[model samples]
Target: MNSPELQNVPLFAFATAMEFSKVFPEDSSKAESQNQLIPLSGPFQGCFACILGVGILDFSAGLASLLFNCKQTNFKISAVISLGICGAYPDRGLSLLDVVNVSSDRVGDLGCEEQDGSHTLWDKSILGGNCCQAPAVIQKMLVALPQVVGATVNCCTGTATTAVERVKNMGCDVESMEGAACFAICQKFNIPAFQIRAVSNIASTRDKSQWKIEEALEKLHKCICG
Candidate 1:
């Protein structure tokens, strides 16, 4: 079922090895623990994919390995697709199992801190706003998928006040720890990229019961497989 253009596509995931395995059961072979990249094959489409772990550190390492692999195999990567679960700002009307296509991404915490405990967002003028957008070709490919603006941060918003502030500051619909980094890296290489995420919880609360990781993962798998 692989599209001719997507034969060697690299799909990146930021979940734990176990979580990734659950979603990609066809990648049953031990991902040669020799390097940062875990080689994978799509069960549905037979496209090349990899589980890049969670957060910025793993992402950096995996991206380097992926580039190296691409060069070694004389392969031209067709697309960079990231799939995972993310927290949502409740006001966006997103539920736990809703999957979203990241239309754009921004680093949520890359700004100066203030003395009075208040915070000001980075000036988009001087800094020119470090943001990445989904490629137009990808937009057309996944136009049926729900779209949202993603804010990437090292820390998740833990309070209602902070969530509201972030929405006002970044106009983001969903938040994750890795989306912006993935987007920026793709943009650097001038690669067409897509970031798809399933909402697992509301950013304003830390309650585990309120989150739905299993349901989100299931929906994410279906969205990516289709």
Candidate 2:
């Protein structure tokens, strides 16, 4: 994905470096032997990283700044490749360390709460509509991987009830905190944006012991760098 056109190259964004640490030169054993690999530690060989922060508000604000602030800094992005870890619904055939391309993601929690314990989620009626997609090139590149729907929530779905609500309302296979925001901002900018995430935990389970973040990061690195 390297090119001389820094302004038009795809930007690889992360919520935090921890999720993408496997791509760091010092952390990636494969990086040491592959000199031709896209150097993603920082700005290198037309590849760059923008930390979208850890949550929705920060991600939205950060993404906005990434586009507008670049004008003053003279840096610009033509596309976005947002990568991170996510929680998959246990029944979705997704397990820890499994990486997949997110075909579409919607914010599952933004809506009004009714007095009768019923909630009305606005995701379906949002002006922009849900279903976000990546650029054609990325879709082609990741054609071999399983493409799944994603739900972006205020937090990880730690309870089975919460997970069921999201699945019933958003009909998503996986959950992340920032996917919808990333896609939303990219759509607003009319730039291609995509998400590829690893399953670090199961959305229907609250047991932290089942989370394998380290292994998920390892898999995520191989998917991108190898």
Candidate 3:
């Protein structure tokens, strides 16, 4: 299948194949690369779709994969859209499968381990803040969606103590493995970016039964389509 035209083509980047399928299952056409698909209808109509599945859930991996895809596109990407699922903090009062427009993302594990074995946050004084801001225009467009501040890490917080510590240290309302990396890459390329996440589970505990993967994916699809 032929790729979407270079101009006005939104790069919808998914972190996994499952996530990609949720958005473009039926109309996805095989292109030059399995990771790349030409989407002809639905929310992805006339859009460039890419799956960053190799990374699984790691910040560095996300960063590398995103940059590589950007290079391969050979086009001035219109916008970088990182769309997937994330774990919401319990204190945020968000329900399962609620879509979130990530207003900002902080790299939660960017600092050193202290002598007391607690993690110390990186100094963001130079940049003036810890959180990486999302595009203002995207934020305006997503005003109807729930907005969340997210923290990205290599691993999700699985225990109560760690969860509390994470919130205290990072001041984030949700957690994901790739949001911050997506933001950074977009900033470097001077492209506007948006990280939209659907809540799949509570970050406080490691309970798969409590997760809503399908519902979250559906919400993600609907939010994007609208």
Top of the candidates by TM-score: 2
TM of each candidate vs. truth: 0.80, 0.82, 0.81
- Candidate 1, residue 170: lDDT: 84
Cα lDDT tens digits for candidate 2, 3-119: 345556666677775664564445334322211223444324546565657878888888787676654565556677878899998677777888888878888888898898777
Clashing pairs in 3: none
How far residue 65's Cα lies from its native spot in candidate 2, in Å, is 0.5
- In model 3, the worst 10-residue window by lDDT is 123-132
> How high is the lDDT of residue 200 in model 1?
85
C-alpha RMSD of each candidate structure in angstroms = 5.0, 5.6, 4.5
Residue-level lDDT tens digits of model 1 in 1-226: 2235544555454546555655666664654343344556544443455667677667757776775666566666656777788998978978888887777887788787789766676623111112243333334446777778888887898988889888988888899887777766666665666777888899985788888988888877776655
Stretches of model 3 off by over 4 angstroms after superposition: 1-5, 28-40, 54-74, 123-141
lDDT of 2 at 78: 64
